[model samples]
Target: MLERDSPTPLYEQVEALIKKNILNKTWPKGKKIPTEAELMKKFGVSRGTLKRAISNLQKNGYLVQRQGLGTFVQADIEIPLERGLYSFAEYFQAHHIDYSNKILSAKIPKKTSKVIADKLGITINDKYLCLRRLREVEGENIMLIENNINISSAPHIETADFSKESLFSIIERYSKETVEYSETKYSAVGANSEVSSYFSIKKGAPILYQEQLVHLSNNSIIEFARVWIKSNHFTLKTILHRK
Candidate 1:
């Protein structure tokens, strides 16, 4: 309902109502909404007004239009996991999608940096398994993840094949511990030389960089991870509720 004195246009009010349905999951991902005529009848608005509302939502990623077919609800642009709750695989599983990982680099590197030692809770000279992997969704390369694991904590690291098995699953199987939570920081940065080549994008292309520290229920750091994600492949959501 548009109020004449509210300063918002009728089309904009209609657009907001459609968006509310989307956010509330009334129109789930990949589902099609009413056609233009149907929406016009339902909202009691003009055809031009309904079209304008749909157009605005499409531009903002809430709806996707097909050339011959009517518009469908967009695939959820964001993973719904909270910042500290789940692993990447958990998030994927919740969305009913399969993800594959390609091992790019793996080595037992001597931990020499002070920062690395502090995070891993080990001596500067302790050993760590440094691993780099590229993750793909629906066969599209979308993220590059690099992780450092304390060798002492992960003693039987070579037994499992990462390509077929889940890294967190294997770690829990071997260590008899579960990751309870994690902390991460997100930022945007230009791809570096190696990252640029690995992602197959241009050198200066923007990427979403996520740095994570995964912790076990025992309060030990389980994984130190850094990731570079393709710019538009993913989105993050945070909810703010007023008390």
Candidate 2:
């Protein structure tokens, strides 16, 4: 039963119902879904709520809508796993897929900005490896990462191929560390010229910006990363368990 008093909105509830049906094979992929009117009657939801739910599902790659026709479940959208914190390497290894990356720039920057200083816990003048990389999955460039690693902590930075290599993996391999958890913040912002170029998007387009600081089990900082993702390329799905 849908919760009326819960904070989750009505349209989201409608979306969840439809998504559950799709996942359970009741509404198999490639089959055209019920029309808006049919769905409104079945779910007992307002037309606006039904439309919003459909739009959300479409944005998440679950449904495809055709002009002058109807919406249908997409054939290519595999059911996504439950969302949680996972390292870049862990994600690839889990799927048994290999990805290619482009090395943009790797250098020791002498003047660390205030933001970088706070993230790496270093002085403003401290030198660090300012690693810039473009990550691609299946020949599509989807993410751009600009990282600042403290030079003192990562002494072997020169040898690491941050392009095809995961920074977290390299850090653990070279420094013997394990990233237990990280503090991350997400927000939407307009993309700048440099950031938009990597994804072939126009400047000022909305992008998802994630600032993360990963820590190891020993309480040492492992890596600090600022990832800029094309808003359309990925969908973030999470499960919130109630106590």
Q: Pick by TM-score: which candidate is best?
A: 1
Predicted candidate 1 versus true structure: per-residue lDDT over 143-167, tens digit per residue: 8988887657667775557776667
List where candidate 1 sits over 4 angstroms from the true fold: 1-77
Candidate 2 local Cα displacement, residue 180, angstroms: 2.3
lDDT for residue 83 in candidate 1, whole number 0-100: 53
Q: Candidate 2 on 1-243: residue-level lDDT in tens? A: 578789999999999999998999899977899999999889888899899999888756578776677888865312234565676656776776556778788988757789888887877887778788787654446678877676566578667877666677777676676667888878899999988777677899888898888777777665688999766636565666799
Q: How close is candidate 2 to the true structure, as a TM-score?
A: 0.64
Candidate lDDT scores, in order, read 0.77, 0.75
